[model samples]
Every structure is written in structure tokens, then in C-alpha cells.
Target: MRRVIIIVLVLLPLAVLAVWIGVRAHRLRPKSAIPAGTSATAPGPQLPSPSSCGAAGRSQLEHYDRSTVYDWLDGGAAPYLDHGFTTSTVATYRFETGGRTLTIEAAAVRFASPRGAAAQAAAETPPGAAPVPGLPGAHSTRDVLVWCRGRDMLRLVSFTPGAETSGPFAALARAWLGGTAP
Candidate 1:
């Protein structure tokens, strides 16, 4: 009986974790096509091209040309790119407001489907992060925001210590996708 109780205790958390992952995967799965000829120029449900990644141009921020390629993301962010990572665009900006200087880094990643992108976003989100204000269901890890729209995964990180950046990150996310994803 003691052995049985120990086995149940050991497996319970694993089972719960599996269920949670499964649910998240289901929630982030790609939606079905809207059918052909439904409406022209309504913005196709297809993934946005990496070349079309919008620039972050808020007045409070100074845009910088410090973009890097895929090889640079091979370290901590490599696991999140497991699902059909085609291309990515990155931008770094500096925000100075109210006697505070904050450095912001944004990356837009293109995946095969929204599910892949959302899964990547979920994978990158750390525990205790909350959903960003403007972007619903998007998480913020104190200094970073992770979100997905259509087939694009967007990440915004504040490089400055103790910088509160949920609002700016949301704005950058909007700018990166030209208003919203798809």
C-alpha cells in the first residue's frame, strides 16, 4: 500500500503537466482556412513574410541597426524555434523617458502556422509572467514579452535592469506586425 501511494504521488504531477501542455497545444493550434474567394485583399490567412517585418518607430524610442541573423539565436532561444522556423528579423531600440533609459530588443520570427508560432511563444514565456496589456494572451517575463499572431512569433525584451516595459513592448509588437498579426 505504501509503494502504491508513492507511485501515485510520483506520477500525478507528471500527468498534470502533460495535460496542461496538451491543452495549451490545442488552444494554440492553427485555425482552418477561410475558403477561397471569400474576400479579396482581406489579408490572406497565410503567414507574413519575414522581409515585411515592420520597424519599431515609437517617438520615445531610438531605432538602432543592430539586427542579427539566425546563427546568433542558436543559444538560449534555439529550443523555441523547433517548430518550422523559416526566417526572423530583429531590431534594437533605446527608450529614454522620465529620466530612465531602457534598451529594447524585438524579434519577429516566421513559422509555418500560427500554432507553431504560438507554441514557440509559450515555450519562451517564463513562469509568473503575465499577459501583456495590448496583446491578449501574450506573456511578459518582467522585461520581455512573447506573443504570436497568424504565423509570426514576436519577442520584445528590455535590456535595462528593472525597466518596466509591458506597454512599450506591446507598442513594438503592434509596430512589428503593422497593427496586428493577420
Candidate 2:
């Protein structure tokens, strides 16, 4: 009986640790922002094609609606949800510049009205971000750009720090905005 108790004491902790790890991994697993029964290729807002923005290949777009925005934005979804966010489309593009490839993530959020988009943009703009040249309602920093066009608010972020102000970043933003006519 003593030997059995000792064995149980040793194995119990290992079993508990295994279960903990499993629970943690289940929580951390990527959640699908797309709603069930909806096709991923469902028609929606048009983002600039990767090739048009000088990217190596096409981008795979993921969409999120008001119900599932948190799966994509996590804690950052609150402000968007509060501001009448309707839908959002996100994509990642790889651009080769100066012999180095950079990954840029872009998200286009549509609101119920132009007012909602403007409000969200203004709320997200930092104190000293410079206005993007020739793009009304657009602001930029070293690694991020936020812009609003009519009922849509578009954001671009560079995974590699300090690449936000690069030429490729601006070109991609411009291409997207040009294609997204009000």
C-alpha cells in the first residue's frame, strides 16, 4: 500500500502538468475569425492585390465580422466594436526591397458610416504621428499607418520595426487607397 501511494503521488503531478499544458495549448490555438458555414472567398471589400503592390505573390485574405473580430484583434477589438465596426478584412504581404524581404500586415475595417470610420481613425492616431502626404485623414509613424476613406478605415503595420516609413510601405498604402474609391 505504501509503494502504491508513492507511485500515485509521483504520477499525479505529471498527469496534472500534462493536463495544464493541454489546456494552455487549446486556449492558445489560433481561432478562426471567419464565421461558420461562410466561405473564405466571400465577396467583400477589395484590398490591393499583392502583385500590384510589388509583392512576390498573392495575399490570402481573412475576414472577420462584428461577432468574431476578437478572434483576430484579441484585446484590440473593443474600440473597433464600440465604433460601429461592420466588417474587417486582413492580409499579409511580403515585399522584396533592397534584397531583403519584409512582411507587412494590412487590415481594412468598414464601419456603419463615414462618421464612425473618422471617429475610429482619430481615436487611434497618436499624438505626433505625421499626416501621410496627399492622403486626407491618413497618419503615419515609423512602422504604422492609419487612414480613413469614407466608411472604411485602413491600417498597415510592419512586422519588422522601423520599416513603416519605407518606400514600399507608402507604395502599398497608396495602391490600396487608390483602388478603394469613395
Candidate 3:
């Protein structure tokens, strides 16, 4: 009876450890970025390929320096992630013209759901932000422009000195919605 009791205690702990490890492994596994054939998991709109953001798109816009990618997941993206933002990649450009420099950042964000994205938009809307005319799903708060369609959210920020952020936020939005790069 003594030997049996010791065996039971040891085995019980080993079983518990095994179950804990299994649960952790399942939780840590990576989820597919864009699931296939499922509306719930599908990202709303397809963002342009990074290659599409080359010179052709850059030249069409004013003050655009060059096309490159920004690490949104590491910067300024924590807040959005907290809401419902899932996978995302950002394309950035440096706009230097007329002795002024402005930074342009654009990204297509996939939220957990379309409704979640809309809710996040509403929550993040700044007070007194006006709807952008001719641009659906767009709002402008100071120098920041945020828009959403389906399950995707797009953001454009113009970092120009002073409050005068007359950059290419509109053009970028148009291009993104039109499935092009700018």
C-alpha cells in the first residue's frame, strides 16, 4: 500500500505537468495570417504588394521621396492591437519637398471582424474629427487620418512640423482603396 501510494502521487504530478505543457503549446502556436475560404478569418481588402509601391506609385504623388516599409507592429501599433487588430504590414515613404519634410505611413490592418474594426474606429475617433469628404470611411483628427472598410483598417499619419499637415493622406487613401500603391 505504501509503494502504491508513492507511485500514485508521482504519476499524478507527471500527468498534471503533461497537461499543462500541452495547453501552453496550443496557446503559443501561431495562427494563420489569412485563413482560406472563411469570411470570419478573411482580411477585408487585399493590400498592394510591396513591389507595387515602387517608383510608379511614388512619382504620382507630390513630395514623396521613396517607398519603403515601416515596422508598424513595433511602433504606434500597440494600441490598435489591443482593440482587435490582427496581422498587418505597413508601407512608409519619406516626403521631402519645398524645404519641408513629412513622413507618410500607410497600413492595411486585419481585424478580428468587420464589426470589431468599426467599433475600434468609433472608439479611436478623436473628438471633433470631421468626416473626410469624397472619402468614405475616412476621418481626420489633427494630422492623423484613419479609415476602415470591411475588416480592414487603414491609417495615414503626416508628421510635418507644426499643425499644417497638408500631406498626401487623401491620395494615399484613394490609392489604397483603389487597390494601387501611392
Candidate 4:
């Protein structure tokens, strides 16, 4: 049983990561930023391409700085990982102080509780899925998921790929809900 335990332990995190990526595929969002404690009443402008939540039809919005992201991060709905790792995001602001220069494409699934959110994320996994921002040969070292919590919160940030590691993604998530980054 020790061998099974060790295998389960080692794969546990990856399983979590897999589920994270999986559910992400189904949770496509719209561009209408919804405010908390209220239901989404309308939609906004849409970005082009895969930016659409291909299926889950989640509401979407994008921000361009860290300051905006911090507002919600401080609101208490921070991101937590499987191994007891949690984040308290301080802020999310611009590095270049200009127009958005990076693009972060994201789709989020929200929850009333952390476990609920995690379970929802896992439960909604997409079939034959891969990384959100990667291509055939590119590989990422960490599991990066862009999410937002709360109602009517916007959750998408886009920019030119060549731009710096802009906080557009963080800002997008913040504009809609609360979350963390990789």
C-alpha cells in the first residue's frame, strides 16, 4: 500500500494541474464584467479568435495593470493550490506605463467556496486538451491558470505576444473577479 500511496502522492499535484487545465477549456467567458452580489445582466465587446470560451460561455473582460488586479485580490478570494500553497496578491500594475503590450487569454469558472471552485474546475475538464497559451513544441514548466471569482467580474486581458510579461492577464482577472497567477 506504501507504493500506491507514494504514487498517488507524487501524481496528486499533477492531477490537480491536469484538472485545472482540463476545466479551463470548458469555461469560456464573455466580455461583460459582472459586479459581485449581482447577476450579469448584459454583455460587452468581444475579442477575436480562441479568446472565446469555446464552450463554457463564461463572461469575459480584460484589464491592463496590477493596481486593478490588487483591488479584488485584497477582497479575500485569493488563489490556492493543492499542496496548501496559497497566494496573497499585493498588486498588479503596468511595467512600461503605456498601452497593453502583452496578451493573456483566459477563461474562468467561479465558485462560492475554494473547494467548490477546485471541484468545479476539475469537474469541467475538456477532452484532448493542452496548454492555453502554448503551441505544439513549446512547453511550460509551471501550470498557469487565469481565473476570477465573484459575480459579474471581468476576466481576460490581451496584448501583442511580443510585449513584456505584462500584468494584463492579472488585470483582466481582477477586473472581473479575484484570483492569483503562476
Candidate 5:
């Protein structure tokens, strides 16, 4: 009976101390801190998207010689071409640089549109010319030219078709643009 009493006395005090330390430690932690055992090394606010990043999506060292841009292409029939079977029309862009004119949009044809080839071809035909048959889902496409001189890169992007993306995609875009990634 005496040994049992002594053992309880020692264990009871230790248990109380342990409970006190645990409560104190819990209260001391910041409300914002992630719980222990979380996988992420650093956790906090996340970026919305890469597009929001200043130059993200928009290329760095980007500048286009507007003068080099020659034509706004529309796809349609090629009844006018020498080797014609109602092929799509090719819009031409003419440019003069270093005393040499370089055309940019000579290859303006849609080879694989869901719409019938006829409709795809019709998108390019000049409006005044005899109206060409349009494909069911044929669409007029608009593109932009961006040249990153330092990178020696020429990019053509379709902005007419507004894009849809998820939160993570937006965050990634914003990050690439300039914001911090998630």
C-alpha cells in the first residue's frame, strides 16, 4: 500500500505537467500556421493566374513591327487560282525591311477544319466574289503577331477565341506573367 501511494504520487505529477505543456504549446502556435505534419514546406497566399503576371502570356522582349503585318486573312473559295478546285483563298501580307520586303501571312489556309473543306475554303473568298458555300461550323479566326527580338521568336496567337481556364491555370498564367506561383 505504501509503494502504490508513492508510485501514484510520482506519475500523477508527471501527467499534470504533461497536460500543462501540451495546452501551453497549443495556445502558443500562430492561428495562421499550418498544422504539424503538413506536407508543404511553405504555405501561404497563392497567385490567381499567370496571365495576371505583368508580362506573362505577353512575352518578354516582345515588339512587333506593325509595318511588317500585311493582311487580315479570311478563309474561303479559291475559284480565282490557276489550279483551282474551290480552294481557300490565301491572304498576303507585304513588308519592307532592310530594303527588302518580307511577306508574313502567305500561308493562310486551314487544312483540317471540322467544317467541310468547301466551307473552310469559303472563309477566304473575297466578299464581292460569288458567295461560296459555308461549312456548318466554319469560323473566322483572328490572330496577333508578337516578335521577341532577343529570343528570336515569332509567335502568332488567336485572341479572338477568348480562353477559359481553371483557378490553377490562372494562377500558373499569372505566375508566368509575373506573379508568384502557388
Candidate 6:
């Protein structure tokens, strides 16, 4: 009976540990970035392909709905949520320039209306942002460019200083905006 009890005690903890590991693995598994009921290849506004912008590589697209926006934006999700955000798609692109690699992050967020998009863009615009040429409702700073069209807003950000003026930035923005026809 004592041997059986010892075996039970050891087996219980092992079982518990196995269950814990399973739970952790489940939580860590990658969730489908595409929204439910939507085909992965559905025709829609998509992030610009790397080849379209001369990017060396591009990350997989990630889509976030209202419920999961926080997973991507955390505290910054509040403004978007308040502005009737519908969905957001994000990706990163890498470009080789001047013997260095630059990473530009891009996001396309859709709102309930054009008014909401303009409001959100206005809220994010800094005092000194200059309007981007040929792209109405678009502005660019030293490292960030933001634009709104209809009910969609697109932002391209670069951490590399002064990357906003690089070839990749312009190409990517142009390619992305070109694909976002009203």
C-alpha cells in the first residue's frame, strides 16, 4: 500500500507537469492572423509585396480585429478603438540601402467611416509633420508617414533615423497606396 501511494504521488505530479506544459504550449501556439470566415487569399487591400517595393524580404501579414487589437497595439489601441476601428493588418519589410539593412514596419487600419479615419489620423499627426506629395491626408515626419483614405489609414514607420526619405519608404508607400484604390 505504501509503495502504491508513493507511485501515485510521483505519477500525480508528473501528470500535473505534463498538463501544465500542454497548456503553455497551447497558449504559445501561433493564432491564425486572418479573421474567421475570411479566405486567406481573399481579394482586398493587401500589404505591398516585397518585390513591389524592392524590399529584400517581408514578414507574414498579421491581421487583428477589435478583440485582438490589444495584442498588437497594447496601450496604443485605445485611440483606434475609440475611433471605431474595424481591423488592422501589419507587416515588416527589409531593404538594403547604403550598405545597411533598414526595416520598415507598415500597418493598414480600417475604420467604420471616412470621418473616423480622418479623426484618428488627425489625432496622431504631429505639429511638424509635412504633407506627403500627391497623397492627400498623408503626412511625413523624419521617421514616420501616416495617411488616411476613405475609411482606411496606412502608416509606415522606420526606426532607422532619417529612413523616411529612403527609396524603400517611398516605393513601399507608393506601392501600398496604389493598391488601396477607393
Scored by lDDT, the top model is 6
lDDT (tens digit, per residue) of candidate 6 on 54-116: 888988777777777787788999999999998877888898887888988988889999999
Model 5, 67-168: lDDT tens digits are 111212212123222122221222223333345433322122222222333432443433443211221222222233321111111122332233321222
Report lDDT (Cα) of residue 73, candidate 5.
21
Candidate 2, residues 94-151, lDDT tens digits: the string is 8888877788888888998899999999987777889877777688887888888999
Against the unseen true structure, what C-alpha lDDT does each candidate score? Answer: 0.61, 0.79, 0.60, 0.35, 0.30, 0.79
Residue 76 displacement in candidate 2 (angstroms): 1.8
10 residues in a row with least lDDT, candidate 6 = 35-44
Q: What's the CA error at residue 89 for candidate 2, in Å?
A: 0.7
The estimated TM-scores of all candidates read 0.57, 0.72, 0.54, 0.24, 0.19, 0.72
Off by over 4 Å in 3: 1-83, 96-99, 161-167
Total clashing pairs for each candidate? 0, 0, 0, 24, 25, 0
* Model 4: residues with Cα > 4 Å off, grouped in runs: 1-101, 111-114, 120-143, 148-163, 178-182
Please report, as a residue range, the 10-residue window in candidate 3 with the lowest summed lDDT: 61-70
Superposed on all Cα atoms, model 1 deviates from the true structure by an RMSD in Å of: 20.3
- Model 1 — TM-score against the truth? 0.57
- Global lDDT for candidate 6? 0.79
Once model 4 is optimally superposed onto the true structure by TM-score, how far is the C-alpha of residue 173 displaced, in angstroms? Answer: 2.2
lDDT of 1: 0.61
